[model samples]
Target: MVTALMELKSLRKAYGETLVELGSENKNIVVLDADVSSSTQTKMFAQKFPNRFFNSGIAEQDMITTAAGLASQGKIPFVSTFAMFATGRTYDQIRNSICYSKFNVKIVATHGGVTVGEDGASHQALEDIALMRNLPNMTVIVPADYNECRQAIKYAVENERPMYIRIPRINLPDIFDNSYKFTLTAKVVEKGDDISIISNGDTLIESIKAGQMLKQKGISAQIIHCPVVKPIDKNILKLISNCKNKMLFTVENHSIVGGLGSAISELITDEGLGLKLVRIGVNDQFGQSGTAEELLDYYGISAIKISEKVIYEMKTTIL
Candidate 1:
């Protein structure tokens, strides 16, 4: 269990501050936004480095292509916009102008998943991960909290590659401290012998809470936080292979079909782990307008719901 009290912090706020810091450190570091700087928190970067920032005025595709052009000229372009428009609206440009050429473009898409409350399904990007992960040469990262987001952004800037970082609109509890180092590997937040619960992004906090709830019900649960969605870490495969019990559950704020759960499923099947896996997420459906809290519960990815599902699955497996 985490010994310190978790502080609530905004991922986008951390991302913006990190961008400003990086901008000051690297003269070649530039930021591009698609007319949503305030919402995506890139306005902070724009304020700090006016000359290095560009607003493309609602044109996501043009912003991506422009970033690619900048990258080709040795500038490390950090692109920002709502997740839906960032990925869904500009997939062709990202695929051709960026990923195809392996341009050094950092796409930090905000307002991901169903948590963009009251915006409904159109604004929510439940399939962004799926879209980005399938693209060649694109590195996908979904940081668990503010600290991770900061580190992930720094990593993206320092390492020149075609990368996609997803940031949610809602503030999440601090899962890692300032000393925490971000890596492209799975982290075991809580260790147990009975079952393992894998998650990332906003769903990781709930997975930790669900682990606690499961412990009270005499079900020892392990919590694994996977920040990188693509290039599934070998450490995760090793952990599952050594588990005492072969049950695994994946929870995410996005759709289960092509999100973390799907990635894990591919890993298990390809590696022949033979673990019994259950996926918990938006079950092949679109999001509706509701509070962030209400939508989490409604989609059955809340801590309470996760614990309940684990208990039920355990009982059924025994029978």
Candidate 2:
């Protein structure tokens, strides 16, 4: 079931608000940061409740371990840091310490994807969804907008399993209205029969735009903003499978290997459905130093790039 309709806000403000709201409800809720409190916007929480906040000083591995320890003692811990360092740098700790043990730790990773911009490839985490979702007990979520991110963070805090919440650094258009509801697994943003554009993360804005473009070209492109990438939304996949046209596209800000595209691919293949699918995302390559828009165009993940590819496939492929 989807949660309450929340108003859209800035990305950093979203994190700060989530921290504050969660703090008010559960005294056991603690927040840990790896010296980037300002970036994660958890420094405000630190100011409000210093006793429950810990700045681990750039040690992501140690922060993960600490969060796991706290969870073991029945505390809900939200670990904050850049996605690259939080997931990439502390994979073992997250995998073994938190997930392997089935500890309920909410790993909130900020600065996800090329949105990290001038931070370059080293700072941009293009493979975080792949990394987090591959874990056995991890609940991976990629919220579409600021409002969705806030609702997802609230939902993650209440969820029992180990979870990872991804949020980009830069804010985009507010897709959801102030009273828009959010569901955990799958939410159909729009419906169509010609083709399905299943997307998540920052690229979702472009996917919405692409859908409009397809509409003008007399092609109906349905949009599904699937925030939860893991634990496949089988029902939606079944609908896509049974559709007569059976053309599908999975778009994301990450690599095509094990992200949203791969998830959708697995969903169709597992159901023995022969769907014509195109995975639109960063191929198996690290991002370079460029603006978010430049990197997207470079990696062929922009709205125009994705629409062009989809149009080409539709025209040339004998599906």
lDDT tens per residue, model 2, 95-179:
9899999999999999988768887989989889999989998888888787787888878777788999888887766777647
The lDDT leader among the candidates is 1
Cα TM-score of candidate 2: 0.94
Off by over 4 Å in 2: 1-9, 241-243
TM-score: model 1 vs. ground truth: 0.98
Question: Any residue pairs clashing in model 1, and if so which?
Answer: none
Every candidate's lDDT: 0.91, 0.84
Model 1: lDDT of residue 238: 76
How displaced is residue 194 in candidate 2, in Å? 0.5
